[model samples]
Target: MKSTKLYFSALLCTLFLFTGCKDYVRGNGNSNDRPDIILTYPELVSMLQHYDKTRKQQFAAAVGKDEDTRINHFNLKDLKDYIAYIEKECKKKNIPLTGINFISGAYPDNYRLDPKKSNYQALIMMPATTIDGEENVSFDPFKSEKGKPLSLKEILEGYSYTSWTYDELKSRKSKKKSSRSTQKGGGNDLSPAGNRTGISPPN
Candidate 1:
């Protein structure tokens, strides 16, 4: 009887440990225990090269050469603060903050081709949630106050981004490759390996 009781207690504890947090999905909870297959720096270079080519071919005429924003990277502190703010807001409304959705968008016509601007064509990161488990919604910040969801234009204007130029991206990739080769040849490893399970867009 004692052994059976102990086994049952252990099982209950295990279940609780796994299912205790239900705030969000994806990387959270035991439902997704498998490790994500992260892309390498080289792989990312290939992917972004393709994307850059595609973006230029598709939107160059409309947005102008080297003016259509191909990528946007955020500051770590800003991203963390934004996530925390969204979580608090969602909690107040009893909505589970499922994930952030990066929806592609364009700025207003006047700012579309400005090299000085951070958002010509950009991805708007919106907090996502499900309504009654049927319809999914991406919550737009400032929607309640302004009667319009936050636009990519507004977001870019408000927050600062440290996006890299296309030339910088190629330069970094070359440096990363060179460093890795030196490390393989028994040279001192100055930096951490780039082969990790996470998406780190060029900064």
Candidate 2:
């Protein structure tokens, strides 16, 4: 009975070891490792070039222009067309177009674009305002103040010195000097012509 019991115990130990080893292997297996094709930089550049040309053409045609305009004035339809073009190019190159992300406008009041860059591994395109007022877009101010419009002096006071032109800076400096002189009774003296006023002069 002792020998039979020892033999059964050994068999049990073997079964346990086998099950443990099987579980360990299963847990560490790489069955889901699949090959994915990625586009090279050259391929991506070519794709972008083609997409840009197509976009320009489509935009011109839709806007009723014979040729492409330097300034991009895109409406909702133009944006959709551009997105579709990018999607098609991405598919051809086996890249995920939806993964690209974009942002527009100032902080706290902007729209996000799709397929945002990850770890700085994406191409980005941003729309810019042109020299001409063709593509100018405005955002309403967050808060409106009810008062008279600020005068030129008030505007200048709030403006940065670096942003001022040479003439503007000189003008502001001259005005400041004139104000100081006036305060010191140098510009206009209110003293009586014949009598020495007892009022002390401003320091």
Candidate 3:
């Protein structure tokens, strides 16, 4: 009877170990498993290509582009910090934040006078609050027409960007894949690269 009890206990322990390993493996394959690093350069290039094909002309009309023209890239840290700051301020004023409002803005031609600035187009952001789940109001403390226009020259001072032409992106796709595989732990190598979303420019 003592030997039988020992055998049953061992069997139960083995079963529990197998169950735990199965759960661990299953968790890794689920949607909750997120990547550590940013999306690879090849991924960004593919997205840019799709955007260029579908919306380049319209974007150019709305906000002109040139070899010197630049797009704004927000730092992950800065964006998060700004959101937190806004939340804190809202809380103090007893305001509830529902979302953010992004307003399109274009710099004047004289904005080039500021050598430090790279952005020709800007997305001005403001924290928004909603009423009765219908009406939304953006909390804009800086809203004023009497004062001199704010200089956003400092806005583009810190960020870095790669200015590769469309042709360059296409050429470097395969090279980037092999090099990135060795550097990026071979993540998403099995997956297809480039715009696989079936969006194409008009022939």
Candidate 4:
């Protein structure tokens, strides 16, 4: 009886180990507890590629390309090569990155309202203000107006962004992978980085 109980217990433990708990999903939950990090352009492209290989091919087709030039035409490799340089720029800007938002870069002008519709619009949060020092690190990359910043609640629900905290994102990292530019880069910019601000978060 004792041996049977031990075996069962071990089995239960193994099952629990294999399946951990699930936190928030689909951009649900407040970021009050932790800082949010946005992925750079290169980072965004890598994630999209990781999650969906077909998307790139589809994107290429949509663009009337002869071949699937997701990396070559987009300058994905160049972005990867310049990853260090980009990190330095982020540090200088003090933009906190949490996780990569996986979406296509096809819709930059808000052509589609639902982020799910476009398949490419990773919206990373800019860093919040420093407490004791307040304005020192306060940033509002999503601000639509002079004193008003776009609400995260609104952004998540409307845009369908999947946000993971930094630790969670680190766990998702794989040995494979790393950008073309919409972001500022090797003079080969692919996408635009977030509007990292040095201003204070509005009251």
Candidate 5:
């Protein structure tokens, strides 16, 4: 009877240890699990392309002139107001609106003044700006009667501007993988001497 009791106790202890080990292994099994909010560069590029298409359509609908020459003088005031609205929304959500780039290029010299000229014929202004400033920037394409700068909100949304938030979350899993790869590759092994003198040290 004593021998049987000792055997049963040893079995129970082994079973508990095995079960704990299995649980520990299962808990950390999958290394591919990453945050859902983080987006890849390709995903961001696709989104920006879609936004550009939508904006172009909206601009065409707003302006009766389809020719690039006529649209070349597009409402800079409205664009500024739109940016302001984006900033306000980002602040409300506590998201830093960095990495937002806007570029507008000037039209070329050959751009024709003819009404029949294609809208693409206008010189692209290629103006670039970002939303990571202390205060929102403003521009006025239209001159007021008093030559004063027009309020962007009034020009863009008529009265109140619409807002949108863009948050890009960082992925810890991806960052960790990148760090591991970098470490395995030997961080900063290729010094200036290594590049200039094609001789590498043998380990």
Candidate 6:
């Protein structure tokens, strides 16, 4: 009887541990000032890259590249550093930020691509504080009374992006040497209907 009771209790605890947090950044939970929700760095990057490419004139002056510059920005190492910097900033501001675990945004069981660094660029619903100081947590992008929300645009205005230039990528030939197009995947996949899963059109 004792062993059986312990087994069920252990199972219940495990389930709670995994499901309760939902992969928010894990540090300094004991705070009223922390952002109820946070947008991870990669999420911001994906948003800006889309705007930079499609919006054309709007971001051209801000990003300073009028041409179609496929801003691959940083490598894996650089991304980790950037995330750390955000974490540091949150700490300084006495605000807690949450992050999520990335999963393969791909489909079709046998498709080829690295899933860890793939699509799933959707803003998640957590909690957040309004500019008026009320914790009206919602899915709407974080904003203040002052201006547009802080995101990659703010980051790019000062950020020094590393190079994965489109021209550079184009110069290299894929090892496959097959019918597959010689295009470097932007770490995303497509749906059966041929939708760009990563930068899907916003609804």
Report lDDT per candidate: 0.49, 0.34, 0.44, 0.38, 0.36, 0.37
User: In model 3, which regions exceed 4 Å deviation?
Assistant: 1-50, 61-64, 67-71, 116-119, 132-136, 141-203
How far residue 203's Cα lies from its native spot in candidate 1, in Å, is 12
Q: Which pairs of residues have clashing backbones in candidate 1?
A: none
Can you give the lDDT of residue 186 in candidate 1?
25
lDDT of 6 by residue, 1-203 (tens): 99999999999999998899655554576444557567789998998888867775653454343432232223456455645654454454544444422222223333355343232232221222222232232111222112222222222223343332212132124323223222322434311111222332211
Each prediction's TM-score versus the true structure = 0.46, 0.17, 0.39, 0.21, 0.19, 0.21
Model 1 TM-score is 0.46
Name the candidate, 4 or 6, with the larger lDDT value: 4
Q: Report the Cα lDDT for candidate 5.
A: 0.36
Q: Which of the numbered candidates is closest to the native, going by highest lDDT?
A: 1
Candidate 1 lDDT, tens digit per residue, 1-203? 99999999999999898899544556465655655767789998998898777766677666554446555666666777778987776565555666776666555555534434533566556676543232234444433222223222222323342241211233334443221111121234222101111121212
Estimate, for each residue in 1-203, the C-alpha lDDT of model 5 and write its tens digit. 99999999999999998887763132357646664668999998998798667765565555443322222333556555555665554454444444233323223344464323323323222111122232322322221112222222223333234331121112222332221111212343321100011111100
Preferred candidate (TM-score higher): 3 or 4: 3
Local lDDT at 24 for model 2: 19
Look at candidate 2 and give me any clashing residue pairs. Answer: 99-115, 100-114, 100-115, 100-116, 101-114, 101-115, 101-116, 102-113
Which of candidates 4 and 5 reaches a greater lDDT?
4
What's the best-to-worst order under TM-score? 1, 3, 4, 6, 5, 2
> Which RMSD values do the candidates have, in order?
18.7, 28.4, 20.3, 19.7, 23.7, 18.8
Q: For model 3, how does the per-residue alpha-carbon lDDT over 104-173 read when each residue is reduced to its tens digit?
A: 5544555554523333555556666543233344443222112221111111111122331212233335
- Could you tell me the TM-score of candidate 3? 0.39
lDDT of 2 by residue, 44-135 (tens): 89987986777756755764444332322335565556556544543444433223222221112121331121111112232112111222
Point out the higher-scoring one by TM-score: 3 or 6. 3
